[model samples]
Target: MATITAVVNLDLPGPTISRHVYGHFAEHLGRCIYGGFWVGEDSDVPNVRGIRRDVVDALRALGIPNLRWPGGCFADDYHWEDGIGPRDQRPRMVNSHWGDVVEDNSFGTHEFMDLCELLGADAYISGNIGSGSVREMSDWIEYLTRADDSPMATLRRANGRDEPWKVPFWGLGNEAWGCGGNLRVEQFASLARQYATYTRDHADNRVYRIAAGAHEDDYHWTETLMRSFDPLDRDDRPATPFQAVSLHYYTRTGSWAEKGKATEFSTDEWYLALSRASWMEELVARHSTVMDRYDPAKKVGLVVDEWGTWWDVEPGTNPGFLYQQNTLRDALVASVHLDAFHRHADRVVMANIAQTVNVLQAMILTDPESGALVLTPTYHVFEMNRGHHDAAALDVHLKGAPEKEVDGRTLGLVSASASTRGDSALVSLSNLDADTAHTVTLDLRGRDVVGHRARVLTAPELAAHNTASAPETVAPRDHDDVRLRDGRLEIDLPAHSYVTLELTLSPTPSQPLVPR
Candidate 1:
């Protein structure tokens, strides 16, 4: 085993890691909507007005901050009016993006809002800009948030909901450079400003409008969008059209033509996945640098609304469904990305995994035939790291950390991130090596540790994953090999594992940490 030393500077706190950074996405793709979250009210599966009960309960336990809805490529094609009226009266449309399946419009505005309420999560709605009009987007906002007797508000009342729903986040479009519309960055930036002008805030429900941003390392797309913010309105004030920009990245071991299998992969692929996941740090840094030239105060956020592992579909699953198995490798990929998000908390305000249930890198997977719900290994990581939500980020510096060579490039073998909330602190660690364990010595500075507890999630094999038959195959368990001595903490992390240490700290004179 290798030994590594890390320093946790608790006193040198950074920005508050927004709880929205722990957000989730639920698109109208494949089983993600129909069988994953919504089973008809008359079905045998237990549910709360068509929303799956087990799914909601499982997500609620993770303290899910927000959920982005009706998206990916579907949001641009979706018309809000088709889903508002009675279920039987609603129109059916072909879901061209996912599968050539028919969308019954069963799970629409009301259903998504109800699911968010059931999980105690905020709604992040993505509007249609590719195939819909500006008035349509504006009316949808009024329909959801207006308190007065506007036309859209009256329609919302007739549909059953009396009070206006609070929509905290609104996405202008999904991917304007591709499925959203094959438009250039300049075209989309101009449209974003025009559409955002009418996405009015109604009553007490304020919307954080997020414009669709670049993919991967497209720095030019980000520059074009940020340049549009230079123009001032009539009052000589900054005409910032959007409060944030969206970035989408997926950890794929293979090319887009052949996104490797979810479960079947060699050791080289494992290292490659983590290597790609770690690239998030560079992406955020470069993008934020571009945004800094425009808004030096860092008021705008970089919302990674869609990110996760995107492997090929399971053997028997439909290609368009994107129903892939979540293995221990996928869990590590999530940890690496989350650590990047934590490190750049100042600019990376919010991030939603590609999906929540029964889709690409889902937190929960469901069996359509048997209605068996199994929490993915990725889900356990989110539940374990929930303490980092809305906490002040603590700088963690590591020395002598091991590294592995993959495809002629070196990949870090260990990952760590820390945060403090009140009298408690959380440190998340991951060991990317698949064969050897490592011992990590944490130097705790500026805080006296009163108590500590640890938990680890790992499997017997790298490809081990959860199934309906054996749900806890790769779940978190209490780890007792953690000790604290003389202001130093030591933990034995197993190979291909994720661990979280929670420490109870003695109060200090430095200011009380406030959550954003």
Candidate 2:
């Protein structure tokens, strides 16, 4: 084994992990909307209001700081009022776009806001901008958040809620490039100004409006939005109206339509999927560069509100709903993406995976027939990495060779990042190679290290999964450890494994190292 030394100079500075980055997204697509979160209040399984009790508890355990609701493609055509009123009285609409299913707006604003309350999370409402009027988008803000006197507020009070939910984070639109009207950035920026104008900000309500940005690496859209922010706004106020800029990214498989196989796939396919997730680094850098040019002092941060793998659903599910299996490989992808977000925490402030449950790489999967739920392998990674939330990103340098080559492209086997909370520090690492085990040394040279314990979340196979029958097969190990000495730690990482080490530092680690 090559003994590479990762000298993390404790004297330098590191970034601060954004709590919003550790967020979950729930969209009105497939079971992600119906079977995933909403299962009717009369079901045998535990439920609070319209949301699932088990799902709420699981999300709380993951320490999800923010939750984006009613989105993805679903946000484009979604009408807020359609999902309000009495569950029985609510008019049913054809979800003509997603899987051609009937969407009874029973789980609308009140339901989503109520669910966020249960999860102890901040609500990120994606406003209707495409094919919806400025009044429609603004009315939603009034109906859900406004207090005292307002037609929407009065309707809200009649619906049985006394006080406003006071939701802080609101997304202006979903995917403007694709499902969200397919307009040029210039056109969309103008429409955003009209929609944002209506989103009422009451005296007590502090709403942060995030304008729709590009999908993936379309920095031009970001550039356009940045340039047009002044022209598109009723008020050229960068502080309140344009609180944040939103971007969407989905980790694609080797292909777009058939996202390869979710679980059963080749190593080459694994590299193909992760290689795309690894591009988050560039996405943040390029988007931040654009934002820097427009708002040089870094006023607006890139909120990657929609992100996750888009693969073929498990066998025979609704194709349009984007339901895919989550595996150990998926967990590594989540880890790498989280690491990227942490590294770029300055600019990339927030992120939310596509759908939290029963859609794409969900943390929890519900078996409605059996009234059972299984936490996916990707969920375990989220649970382990929750330590990075709101914590200061510490310096971590890796001294390891590239894992392998996929179609002439090199793959990174060892992935690592550091975060600190007061005097305690945490280090997370992942080895994506399936065949060879690695004896890696983690050198925390700058930070004054003392004693630490490691927890490993790994699997014997890269294609390992956590089914309803065997949920614990790929769960995180709370007491796993690596051999650590003064300022140095050595770990034995098996092929296709992930670990998070909790180090109790002698002093608080704050100086971020300038990456060499």
Q: Which one is best on lDDT?
A: 1
Residue pair clashes in candidate 1 = none
TM-score to true structure, per model: 0.97, 0.94
Candidate 1 lDDT over residue span 1-516, tens digit each: 888999998777899999999999999998999999999899899999988899999999999999999998999999999998899999999999998889989889999999989999999999999999999999999999998899999999999999999999999998999999988999999999999999989999988999999998999998899888854323577657898998999989899989988899998888898888888888999999998887777878999999999999999889999999999999999999999999999999999998999999999999887899999999999999999999999988889899877766678899999999988999999999999999999988887677788999999899999999999999999999886555477899999999999888779644332211
Off by over 4 Å in 2: 10-13, 231-240, 478-481, 485-487, 508-516
lDDT of each: 0.91, 0.79
Clashing pairs in 2: 10-446, 12-511, 12-512, 13-511, 13-512, 14-512, 83-105, 454-480
The candidate that achieves the highest TM-score relative to the unseen native structure = 1
Model 1: worst 10 consecutive residues (lDDT sum):
507-516
Name the lDDT of candidate 1: 0.91
Error of 1 at 293 (Å): 1.4
